[model samples]
Target: MSLTKDGPTPPPATARRGFLDVRDLVVHFFTDDGVVNAVDGLSFSVEPGRTLGIVGESGSGKSVTSLSIMGLNRGRGTKISGEIWLEGQELISASTEEIRALRGSKMAMIFQDPLSAMHPFFSIGAQISEAYRVHNDVSKKAARVRTIELLDRVGIPSPNTRVDDYPHQFSGGMRQRAMIAMALSCDPRLLIADEPTTALDVTVQAQILDLLRDLQKEFNSAIVLITHDLGVIAEATDEVLVMYAGRGVEYGPVKELFAAPEHPYTWGLLQSMTRLDRKDQDRLRPVLGSPPSLIHVPSGCPFHPRCPYDAQAAPASREIRPNLIETTPGHQVACHLEPAERQRIFREEVSPGL
Candidate 1:
């Protein structure tokens, strides 16, 4: 797919290199039960034209981290602290008005559900054009033209007439395409896609992923994809972040992390995937137990309770809460066990086939 030159001028060289940099991000919600730490000291960066996938099980703070970046947690008795830098500008310290200006213009998020993101009252074209008009000083006619162009660019057929139809008039895949068109209306510098293909069929999921890849290449936008699916991360991302119990336990290049995952939680995730691929008679290797409650997390390692290797037999693995150490170049893992021991477990216990 060819690049698009529809939006604002690109940032200068230095600024463009680090498009989105998040550091030590923490988000906590106050509830009657207790304070729930949704995101605890998470950090990552996405350079221009790169995709970073944040993967984990449900309630692992993936969505919370993305929403924190988008400043969507405001006014909810939620406490957030950390640095979210978009081209060196700090998003955490930015005021509501400032973040509002940046959203949908400099950075836009494609929600998991298109139905929730789109307004049922307005036509698809009107919604897409409105996104453009909100950021750019273009006339409605010009915005409408841009909207049609985006619709066609996103692989929607008969966009000229389809643009006039409301959200309910389109099929599930069409709605997702319309959502993508709206997200790209102002040609955002960073795109945060939170499970953008969740509700679609497998064929539609592939189409949406392809569309996102094509659009990212065309616009030169940094993308942060938040999803639980390893297949999606493996296929669509350059780097991966594995979150567990509100903290990042493993992070590195996709290839390195997949080949020799050091974290026990990551090993569990891989084993779970392997079990899914095995025959029905094969015993499924689930992660063992449920993730600990955020309100009252376990001591030492957050994943200790469910960790298969954190026991007497695996004495080395139960030592302490491991810091995220670099096991190899650009590959980091949080585990107490030695590299060789971890490798042995990952190869034999987790994935014997590999």
Candidate 2:
């Protein structure tokens, strides 16, 4: 199936604008060194049958946001706030037992590394069956049949026999597919995939993305796809949320953001991507400098230290943090640059190089 932004007509909507809504979410880890603000005042929403891609460099709090949404960050030393509304149910205030019951039924997660996520000792069928049995009351024989069907649906060959194989027996791609199957076992309404294509070859990555698109279409599930790969975002997501230093710096429809990104950090990210369409033989340009430490994040705009255009905003960019402001109907950006100036820069300077 084509992974285009356009897809089948969605099911009728309710009064709510988002099937999954996250508002001003904050997640901090109180380490011995200091409090690490992993996710700070981040907000976004996803409607059913639409995929929202969260992209950022490492340490930008992409995974932390997903984990927080899944209620997997509950423990000592971690502090979380803000609202996570799934189908109008508030997840942050929900009890641990409530969240546990909701997982794999109302929502599910596909972890970055399936090899580590899955238990090595358990057979694939046993694991999937157990997950199914948790949210569903079914006989072992019935659960096993459902497990085999899921394995088959995910394109594992000879599901009847392969279901008995251990996680160690599967290839990286196969393992990832199995993880997807497990996440979809209960036909959840929301799915979070964290770096699902990591460590896979290009062919396998494409296949996985295609499979995700097909499955999303089939299930009409709201998806949060967290990854650093811009190509994947462009290919599979209806919207994109660009994170920087634990906050969203830019967000909009995927195509529009790619066409005219408003933030300097976003320009840097696009420049860093290896473009197959460009005619020049120039070397790939990377976004200069490493990400900032979350424990002691830079004052004001967290990205100002490395922003090439920070001089445009001068001390203001250094003295004050910018909140996301609408630059267009749906596009929002957190930058001090004037909207007109941003467009001029992208058109005259950044676009040619990109």
* TM-score of each predicted structure versus truth: 0.91, 0.95
Compute the lDDT for candidate 2. 0.89
Instruction: Please identify model 1 stretches exceeding 4 Å from their true place.
Output: 1-17, 274-280, 312-320
Decoy 1 TM-score against native: 0.91
Cα lDDT tens digits for candidate 2, 1-354: 111111123223343546798777889999999999999888788989999999999999999999998899999999998778898898999999999999999899998888999999999889999999999999999999999999999999999999999999999999999999999999999999999998788899999999999999999999999999999999999999999989899989999999999999989888888877876776677889999999989988999999999899878899888888778888889898999999999999998898
Q: Which regions of candidate 2 fall more than 4 Å away from where they truly are?
A: 1-17
Model 2 weakest lDDT span, ten residues long: 1-10
Q: What TM-score should be assigned to candidate 2?
A: 0.95
lDDT (tens digit, per residue) of candidate 1 on 52-138: 999999999999999899998876779998668898798999999999999999999898889877999999999999999998999
Identify the candidate with maximal TM-score: 2
Total backbone collisions for each predicted model = 0, 0
